[model samples]
Target: MTQTANRFHRWFAEPGPRPPLGTWLMSAAPSTAEAMGHCGFDFLVVDMEHVPIGVPETASILRAIAGTPAEPLIRLAWNDQVLVKRVMDAGGKTLMFPFIQTAEEARAAVSYTRYPPQGVRGVAAVHRGSQFGRAPDYLKTANDQVCVILQLETPEAVERLDEIAATPGVDALFLGPGDLSASMGRIGEIAHPEVQGLIAHAARAAARAGKPIGIVGPNPEMVGGFLGMGYTFAAVASDMAMMTGRAVEWLAALQGRVQAAEPAAAY
Candidate 1:
């Protein structure tokens, strides 16, 4: 279908309250994507990075999300160009590039979504992004329209955070807490004071550089705090986390003094 306005893109550029809130979709199920889309989230991430979702499935999720107000964003498994091209061709409007540790990597990720002369994305006028060739003006607009957000999860990345945020064509920066904690040797202790300090530092650096930065948390409290600390956007929780959490919560209410189910292994 032809997209007339870039709502998500404008959300960032517009002066507003906290930049939108979002959540991770690792379910790979179109039903889940559609359900979450209708839940009023400002955006929904179709996660291919940790989820076992392939290109075709991603397209399905995109279609499902397209039916609602939530803007669909895809997190690529790596900083690979082919994956970038395929995701864009499938009509993913925004891409979240993971584990980007340097400025060069940040630039490369943006380049993958653009055409040559501006960037290196291969042109495909007949792809879904062009509504299968129905939208003749797609080629002229796609380059300026696709949004890019890079994930910085390591201390090395935070150390050079300013440079990475300054990279040309990079729209926003996202902190991956799970990986950042690991990089800090805290290994899942995201709340440990040391990790918190580094995270706060990165947030301030990004703010000074005048870029909207965001983070994903396993819970609302943590993500809420990040927004308080000056993050522009955040994904407060994941589909899996909310599903299992509510199941356990309701079960405990029924069975007095019952224990919550064993936690799933962290991905």
Candidate 2:
């Protein structure tokens, strides 16, 4: 079996001049995954945190991204060993953990992705990640090949940001705007002065520790700030947001046409 370099890992190892762009898929559908991939995104994060996607369904999404250039990643609901192993085995190269608040949590998240000496991920060659029972030596090199990204979403996480960034094997740190804002007692105020300062500090801490920072910002203005702050990886928006925004736009235009036609019909 030929060895293939994981793009997710490459992004961290050498995140050149410009940070790579990504999008989120929370609907857990293969069609969305294929569309996001074909749309020229560098990566697409299959969000399982709030999505009702099971392991098998996630595998289906990964399969849809198989022939595309976009990298496949997933934000597991929690940092459990089973979920981490299952998603990775299903071909998710980058695994993002949510609500990580300490260095130990970061370590555990990263360790779960490795095997033995490095981590506790069970060895399984009978999965699609190993080429569907083809590459029998996946366990031997997978530990070093996978990317582990931990999220800093709470005030506690920001307080311990340095320690988390210093954790070995932690490839990147993701900033969760909504959760972090809520945690800071400023619900829905992701753009608040205090929230912005914390985010900036977290990004700097990650950079100082030699790790990349990632974030989920949809609006161009917000995303631009994250990129300008030197976040190496960031998501533009989510699948659900895209659908809702377009639907609203389409419906408003359709309603206007219908109303205009009603006035003309009286003549």
Candidate 3:
């Protein structure tokens, strides 16, 4: 098997007709993941941060996404070297590290994805990343194929956006509004003026650093706002959130308590 370039990285390197739109996969079910992959999303984030997914389950999810047009982006639970090595060995080419606060932390995250001399990733000759040792050039080419997206979840992290984006091997930046809100003493109020200002500031900072930035919103309207602010990519809610929100809407309509609202534009 010949090694291929990471589609996530290539997608940003070469601009598409429109920015890629994606959704979160918090279900932790391969069947659910495969089903969502066929829904025409540009990518599906296999979230290991808040979900109960482990290395083995993450590998299974990656396999499920292989047959779809969407690329799989693994969001690590934390910025740990062991976890990074395990996921990369399990065939995760694109990774999102959460809660990166400093340029050093961003550099550390990048190093974890690289092999010796370039990084400290432990070697494994016969793992899924190397196609079970069938791909002769996997080791040599893996570093370039790995796309590292670091998440900035607080004001402190956003303050170092330029330094973080300048770090070699960091491919993209993500702003986590939920945590940012909490850190600002306004839990559950992502729409607060202060939070919005910070998010917009981060977007400008990312553009200045010449790095692609991404964000996730609870609905299409919010995501659209982020896109207007020059976010290169954005995810609109999660599988569970969409499912539950629709269920509640239908329940309300069936009982005649309220009329069903017009469907919001996707993407």
Candidate 4:
């Protein structure tokens, strides 16, 4: 493992004063990757599950983040072994697995991240994770340095959260509000009273278990709300959304000024 990967590993074991803030960067564009790193976020979650980022493109994006301090995280589409190993092989140190609902899933995630007694992650230090195939201590250190985060997105997951948290090698628990709300029969209403209550309950459980929790909200208001509720890590927004929102607002303002100027000129 590289020093950067070791840093994230230490973060989990020692814990930190403040939970780092990151933004989700789903667009596979190299420019998007560079912009996300330059935006000053502590980390960036590269979306592989929903986006069309194949292995090669993902590697390029990771390279794009090389000069910046912001860490690159990949959210694998599913809990498949091939996908997990591929991401790790391609220089991914932190991974967010989706809809992990049971201890078995947690164990599987751990197994895929490690080698031997720790896991069955293929033994090959010849990837970007090993500094383009050359971290001498890669095998001995990879397991210890990887950060494994699981998404709790269903009612069943909420009920079994304690067990999941207790599962060894599970670094963090993240809440997928949209899916959680939908599972609770309140689709698209994450802020509904009952939904909020459920979130609070889960947060309390995670806090008591001493595992960091993560969330994604569009703006500071929602980010503040999650942090105030005891969530350790939070993603304030997405790269795509941030860019689109700024562009739309700027265009609207410019068009409004143009319309006003047109009326005055007609006088």
Q: What lDDT score belongs to each candidate, Candidate 1 first?
A: 0.87, 0.86, 0.93, 0.85
* Predicted candidate 2 versus true structure: per-residue lDDT over 1-267, tens digit per residue: 754787877778776777888888987889878987998889899888989998999999988987788887788999899999888888887888999989988889988999898888888768788887777577787777788889889988888888998999988889898899998899989899999998888888888878888898977789999888878888988878988999999999999999989978999
Q: What CA root-mean-square deviation does each model show from the true structure?
A: 5.8, 1.5, 5.7, 1.6
Give the poorly placed runs of model 2, Cα more than 4 Å off. Answer: none
Where does candidate 4 stray beyond 4 Å? 14-17
Q: Which residue pairs collide in model 1, if any?
A: none
| Candidate 3 Cα outliers beyond 4 Å, as residue runs | 257-267
lDDT of 2 at 137: 76
lDDT of 2 at 92: 81
TM-score of each: 0.94, 0.95, 0.94, 0.95
Residues 198-258 of candidate 1 have per-residue lDDT tens digits of: 8888889998999888898888888888888888888977898899999999887977533
TM-score of 3: 0.94
lDDT of 3 by residue, 89-179 (tens): 9999999999999999998999999998899999989999899999978888888889999999999999889999999999999999999
Candidate with top lDDT is: 3
Model 4, 159-226: lDDT tens digits are 99999999999888999988999999999998899988888888999999988888888788978888
* TM-score of decoy 2: 0.95
lDDT of 2: 0.86
